[model samples]
Target: MTKPITILVVEDEMIIGAKISLLLTKLGYEVTGIVPKGEEAILYIQQNAPDIVLLDIHLRGQMDGIDTAREILKEGHKTVLIYLTANTDEETFNRAKQTRPFAFLSKPIQPQELQRTIELTVERILVQREVNLQEDKPLPQETNEELMLLQDRIFVSSKNKLVKIFINDILYLVAERSYCQIFTKDQQFILSVPLKSVEHKLQTAQFLRVHRSYLVNIKAIDEISQNYVFINKKAIPMVETAKEELFKRLNKV
Candidate 1:
C-alpha cells in the first residue's frame, strides 16, 4: 500500500484552519498539524517534516508566509509549498514569486480546486523525487505498459503510478535542461524526458516543434506573428524549416 500524503496547514484563523484540516482528511490525506502562526509552522516543519504545506500569507507573529517559505525552501527538501491568501497586491505577489511556491490559492477556497491542486502538486513532488534519485528506469517495449497513448489521451508516469491526461490540455512544452516542462491550460508538469523523446511520445500532428527547445500545441495558438507564435501568452519562435511546416499545416484561409 502507498503511504498517505502528509500535509501541514498554517492559517491564523482557527475556523478556516480546522475546516482545511477536515477537508484534507476527507480527501484521504494525513494532516500533520494545523498551525496558527508562521513561527509555529516553522517549528512543526523543523521537528516533523510534512509532504506539503498550506501556508497563509498573512499570519500571526514576526514571520509572514513568504519569509517562512523562503526559510523552508532553503532547506531544499522535496516538500511542496502552496500559499493560501486573499491578498492580491502586486508587492505581495512579487515577493511570493521569489519563494517559488508550487501554487497560490485565494481565501474561501473551493473544495474542488483545493483537491485538484493537492493531487497535481503531489504528483509533481513525487516525480521530482524520482528524478533526483534517478530511480526511473527505461523499460522494454512489452514491459513499459504503464504509459499508454490513445487517440485523445495519454498516460504518463507520475511517481509510482501512471496518470492519464487529455492531449487537448497541453498548451506547450519547454526544455528544462534534461527534463521537459509540460504546460497545460491551468497546470504544468516536469517530465524526466528529453525534448525529442517527448515529441516521439506525443505522436500528434497538432503538437509542432517550433523551436529546438519548444514544442507547442497548434490548437492552443492564439496568433502567429513573424518568427513567433503565441500560446498561453508565451511567444514560441520557430526555425526556418519549422516555420514553413507550421504554415503548411495551418493552410490559412
Candidate 2:
C-alpha cells in the first residue's frame, strides 16, 4: 500500500494552523507537524522530512516563511513546499514565485483548489519516480526494440557516459556526424551513434522519418503548412515527399 503524503503546516495563527491541518487530514494526508512559527517549523523539518510543506509567508519567529522555504530547498530535500499567503497582489505573487513553490494557495483556502494542487503534486512525484527508475536501470548494447515500447526509456552513450533518456519526453531526433541529436520538451542531448542504427532501434510507428536527417515524433507535430511542420513552436523541415506519408499517418488518427 502507498503511504499517505505526510505534510508539515507552518502558520502563525493557532486557529488557521489547526484548520489547515484538519483539512489536509480530511483529504487523506497525514499532518506530521503543526507549528505556529518558522523556527519550530525549520526544526521539525531538520528532524523529520515530510513529503510536502505547507508554509505561510508571515510567521512569528526568527525566520520568515519565505526565507525558511529557501533554506529548506538549499538543504537538498525533495519536499514539495507550497506557499499559503493572503497577499494576492502582483508584486507579492512575483516575490513568492521567485522561490518556485509547488503551489501557492490564497488565504481562506478553497477545498477544490487545495485538492487539485495536492493531486497534481502527487502525480508529478509519480512521474519523477518513473524517471528515476529509468535512470537506475542498466544499459545494454545491441538494443531490444520492444524495450522502448514497454518502458518508454533508453540508455545511450553520450560523451563516454551512460545517459538515461525517457523516450516519451523526446520530440524529435536529428542526425549529426557520427551522432544523433535528441530533442526533448525541456532539453537536448547528443549521443554518439549512427542515425541508421538509432532508426533501427526505434522503429516504432510513433516516430517517422520526415526528412533524411530528421526523425520526428508523429504525436508531437502541432501543425503543418507549406512543407514546414510546427512542433510546439519549433519548426521541423517537412519535405514534399514525406508530406504525403505524414498526411497519411495523421489522417489515420
Worst 10 residues of 2 by lDDT: 141-150
Tens digits of per-residue lDDT for model 2 on 1-253? 5556688988988899899888878988789989887778777888998878889987657787787887887777778888888876786667677877877778988886677667656655554444454447663443322223335777765434556787777798877445566778887655546566778888687888887767888888888876567676666666688999888887888
User: TM-scores, in order shown?
Assistant: 0.61, 0.55
lDDT of 2: 0.74
Instruction: Give lDDT for model 1.
Output: 0.79
Instruction: State each model's CA lDDT, in order.
Output: 0.79, 0.74
TM-score of candidate 2 to 2 decimals: 0.55
Tens-place lDDT per residue, model 1, 120-178, is 67765665554565536653343234347798987776555666779998898877456
